[model samples]
Target: MIRLVTLQSGIAQGLLWAILTIGVYITYRILDFADLTIEGTFPLGAAVTVVLINSGMNPFLATAVAMLAGPLAGLSTGILNTVFKIPGILSGILSMIALYSVNIRIMSDKATVAIAGNSIKKIVATLFPAGTVSNTLSTTVGIIVCAALIATLYWFFGTETGCAIRATGNNSKMSRSMGINTDMMTIIGLMLSNAIVALSGSLIAQFDYGSALVNMGQGTIVIGLASVIIGEVILIHKEHNFAYRLFSVVFGAIVYRTIISVVLTISGFKATDIKIITAIIVAIALSIPVFKEKAAMRKKRNLAMKEGK
Candidate 1:
């Protein structure tokens, strides 16, 4: 049944993944690297957070610890790429493969770790003391985290270091010529990206999934890329502002999840078909610019023909 609850859950899930999209945006867009490490980083965050929560650590502190753990993976990728002279994509891939084992270790060699009983204090619980695992509570937690993330990112990107990172992404050679340590910028950007990816995983474990599964983050990189592409399509004037683009990415994630939810409800789409749907969505979104260019060319051709006639 396509109930209101379903829509709310979709929105909430979108919000959580929006954080992941932002993390991906930093590495893919800002650092100009396809960081596959994020695929493993997400689940690592969830596994670490869940384990800490089960061990009776404060949820906020547990989340922080998990967030910090993300940078270690990023650092490994960075070292491989920068120091060992590995290609960016291959370095990220190697780190991601290694993280699967690391995530397993974090989960105590378990495939899944469930957050335990009433003794656990998660962020959503702290936000709504009286409420059960309702859509409203989940949505609130998502909103709070998303808002804080956006504001912090916006401010950070305006700083000198952030500008250097962007410059590195835009033109590494030019940035190097300009006396910026492009290598450091790339490492910092990756670290920042994976940190947020980890944060999203932690919140998902606590707020949405209520359990940490090793394979839960599979195919997440594509989802993040699709979300970013959808946002670019929605915002026609993407050059106007950085903040707007970030906001659009969040909107894109929500819209994509809502569409999926509706499809699942109305068409009886299998849960396993989600990857196929995501692939279709990305293909369509990516083709929009080419379609627009073709239309403009056709219009100009007709106008030129009429003037010649």
Candidate 2:
């Protein structure tokens, strides 16, 4: 039997991870590049949000600003890769390292902040009219806002600029040959991806009992990639529609979180094992195409043998 509370928590965690999955989607899927900077930027956003909220800023506004910071982080990585001619992987690594100091600064020079005192929930309570209705209203507001943002992203990806971005990812050489500035597209795509990641981190800091630590973003990229892969595994057939494919990342993120929740609920599973499990899952997902190819050949050979008989 499934626990309702655990199920809801898993869904919330999944939604949070969706933001990271989208970020990875931009670099891994869209740009056809590997970017490690996401791991740092996620924590940076959370740190920034925590600091601002503790200082009496509006939690929602703080989270929004935090999201905006993600693009700037991505832009730095893009510049390193494109302008300096650094390898995509190396550029992402350099940017991720540099962001550690920036994240610390964002946290007001603290390694972590305790949010038990000044929290988004407290702010919501004060802002809304007193009673149980207020709590429901706040939760509803957050969910609606997040859902709207996701929907808007879906629509935006269908626009002309978005198409250019996708083209840059699908075929950089061809895109350049057709007069598209592939470099510009790369920068823009990373910016958009990281921005969503930051937004997710900011919201998570608020929702997951407040507070943010310097290492909060560790393993973020892996989690995002796992979500993308898990979603693909579930909706293996929707590869044709770009919109649906993008949305699949979100669903995958949720599913990934749900699985983790179930595992944790079962006794004796160490939470730290999550990273190990995620890596294995991604590896298995990556092998799917290869396995399918081998299976197809075997099937073809069996059919030929039957024909000969």
Report the poorest 10 consecutive residues by lDDT, candidate 2: 132-141
List per-candidate RMSD values in Å: 2.1, 2.8
TM-score of the candidate numbered 2? 0.89
Superposition TM-score, candidate 1 onto the true structure:
0.93
| lDDT string, candidate 2, 1-309, tens digits | 668766776776777667678778878987898889988888878887888877877777788888888899999999999899999999989989999999988777888887644656666666666774432533454456546656777777789888888899899899899888989989998888888888777767776646788888888888888889889888867446765776788789888888888877888889898888788878888899899999999999999999999
Which ranges of candidate 1 are over 4 A from the true structure?
1-3, 117-123, 126-133, 236-238, 304-309
Which candidate achieves the best TM-score against the true structure? 1
User: Looking at model 1, which ten-residue stretch has the lowest summed lDDT?
Assistant: 117-126
**Model 1 lDDT per residue over 1-309, tens place:** 678877887897889889999999999888989999998999999999899988988878888999999999999999899989899999999999999999999899999999884212344566565756656665777788888888999999999999999999999999999999999999999999999999989888887778899998898988999988887777746365777878888887887787787778866689899999999998898898899999999999999999999
